[model samples]
Target: MTGAPPDVSIHHLRAITNESTVELPDRVVEILAAVGPDTDVLVSDVSARSFAAATRRSYSKQEPNLVPFINSLQALGDELVLICQVEHGDELVTAVVRATDRSLVAATAIDRSVGIVHITVQELCARLRASNAPGVELALEVASQCLADDRVRIFEQGALSTARTVLTKYTMAAEKGFDVRGLDGFAGALVPLGDEQPGFCIVQADTSVGITAFTPGNADVVAAMGIGGLSLHSETTEETG
Candidate 1:
């Protein structure tokens, strides 16, 4: 006989700012808890598990019923907050919102296994940050500029070795680099160590390799290699420049 389905669980909860990662704050927790046990929370179907699937399943027009809920989360502050809830053998719900004028960037539910919820959320966060976060925009801009310059080719002697040197130069120039843990295509934050700025590089791995850098107020020279698809080997931090 088949075993009973797994119970609902919160797979991930964290707020990301330009500076650091913040655990679910007390106020935000209270708002979510207030939805009450009896509320019929809308969750996505199991078939839409990956990012593409979730996007396909997303509502073309925001549901009026969800507006208040989204607003409540956005009211918290400007920090980008992500919440992921999973019910094994059933549905998964994820919400991402922030207070840059307070809007919901993403709210989706998909069929997902409990084992992979963390990975799913990590990817979701990375994509959202890359496309939306101002800090990430600045970092990518720096990277793109480096790619346009021929001078960046000086470090292409070895793929992996060049990647390390590139990252090292970036870390040194930025003053620090915060390890981004599980996300591919993301190396780390290349902002000043103590400054409250948000800047990060996206490294895509391929035959060649290089690095890039960014500063909050002024631009600085970094590194660059090649470009195509995005992939980052966690251990080596190797990716396309």
Candidate 2:
């Protein structure tokens, strides 16, 4: 199917509920009747329950730079796919995120139309340190896949907090090479390198999974210091965090 969205029938649109109604843009709501009653659909934003208030500032909306998602319950048709799986245009669009308490909780995305799907800090960090757990490897694999698409964009989140990103150059081409399949986009490779102890490192390989050492403006140091990798392309360079 070329990974692009396909034409969905009218019999598949899911309605939005109070729980996951945040991402539903006004435009998406306007198109609901267009999909017909039976159209298939999916939703990838917001949850019946709130995400854990784990950010540096839980008042994310107050700080424009800290927000993760922007919309809720708004899709054009019945068969809307936010991340090729997260359904949109449906009332049951709330996504379940693994909470810190070991129970599944609902978390919403600002915009589920594209980019990487968040697996949650608890799940991601644990998996990244699991010795040989497939979760860490899978995250790397998705990041590797993203660099291939010319339209993709990779942005790293501070492994710990909402700090600005360090590396600006991210070249995953054959010269340096990567080994992953079904990459979501360039955004995947932008690993979150936190400055906390046990910094991130980078290991080269046909399919080797390693850490990425990163410090703001020290992209060059990652080489000698055995740290995380950085993004490439001068044009992509911005003071973006």
Candidate 3:
């Protein structure tokens, strides 16, 4: 039993120019600003149970169809889908687009290549604001079925699964430090807090010690640990901030 399926809501959003004749909603503008450009974006609302199950499966060798699961949200309510490629690092921010009160939603980056993301929402808006292009009014049922079929080809290939696994490890490393490293199915590096940071010590996979992040100019912090120490942060928030 992986877990329960998450209750998902699907929203369809399209890019509209700032100078477009149509009036845009504040929610749409804010999301566009946070996400920026480049990379495709998929919006969905899923039950915490389903999301947890998917997250568990993500750690497994088998791959799960994320977009298909997202598409399934269409039938629950109005379907609003925005397809944009979010850049690997910077443009990968996620948010929740509601019917009228759109707000930021915490998202865990799954497969960045295809922009597969997870969000929990109870319902979605009936329509989007300030759209001058076609494809914004996709039928809920049609989009769901089409996405289900398309996800099959990708799942069979297994690339998405592999990517998700590596990315998940990377996220864990950055957040929880290298202590989470060396666990089964985890493969990644200990990145320093900054380009020229000195407090962080990079350790190799074969070594027993784990790598971690830290603020620059904190050699004393590293010295106190005596070589195998993995410092995730320093006393000051200067670099961490």
Candidate 4:
């Protein structure tokens, strides 16, 4: 990661929804600490499910490869997210890597503009301890990717399917603001706790709402699940409107 770049930025803990957008890599970790360490930082992952079924101009480059492009990062053991779209941005600039936990090198930012990023493990150890070169192979490659993260088992299995439906009712939420993400099959925005309220969730009296997460595997069950609650219905009532 080259190190030394974290000083409260991710635009300060990202939380942007409504048509969605999130790009906060601490200014790409301060431009990868002003570039060095022999370059080699390649990882392009414009995810959140490749915008509802791959089509960021179809990964551009003359358009062709529709799906089937995850070559490295070592077998990808789940926790798969990776971003870099920013040519315009509906949103998706993830993929944060400079190697604190190394294992980077997956291509396709349309063609090979990889800066590698699929952060978590606390934004990859706060961008590798604000990377300026968190050496020792970037702290043993971020401690073997925080012991092989697996996106915290895919965000605790989407937070136990939103904690077993948390008392049902198209129960929308966001008081503590959780986060979620679905890539490839598309899904990102309201990742934390915002949408998913086909019904309840108003609490305006000065508001309180807590809980900081709910995953449902980041939803993408075939698309159609904007976050919070309503994994293609099991009861958010059959009408929702």
Q: Which is the leading candidate under TM-score? A: 2
lDDT of each residue in 84-113, candidate 2, tens digit only = 112232221223322122122223323322
In model 2, the runs with Cα more than 4 Å from the true position are 1-25, 31-48, 51-132, 135-241
Clashes of each: 8, 48, 23, 43
lDDT of 4 by residue, 22-77 (tens): 22234434443443344322123222332323333323234344233332322344
> Which candidate tops lDDT?
1
Give the worst 10-residue stretch by lDDT in candidate 3.
Answer: 119-128
**Model 4, position 172: C-alpha lDDT score:** 40
> In angstroms, how far off is 192's CA in candidate 1?
7.0
Off by over 4 Å in 4: 1-69, 75-90, 100-205, 218-241
- What lDDT score belongs to each candidate, Candidate 1 first? 0.30, 0.28, 0.27, 0.26
TM-scores, all models, native as reference: 0.21, 0.23, 0.20, 0.20
Between 2 and 3, whose TM-score is larger? Answer: 2
Give the per-residue lDDT of model 1 (tens digit) for 58-108. 321333334444444444433433233322222334445332322334443
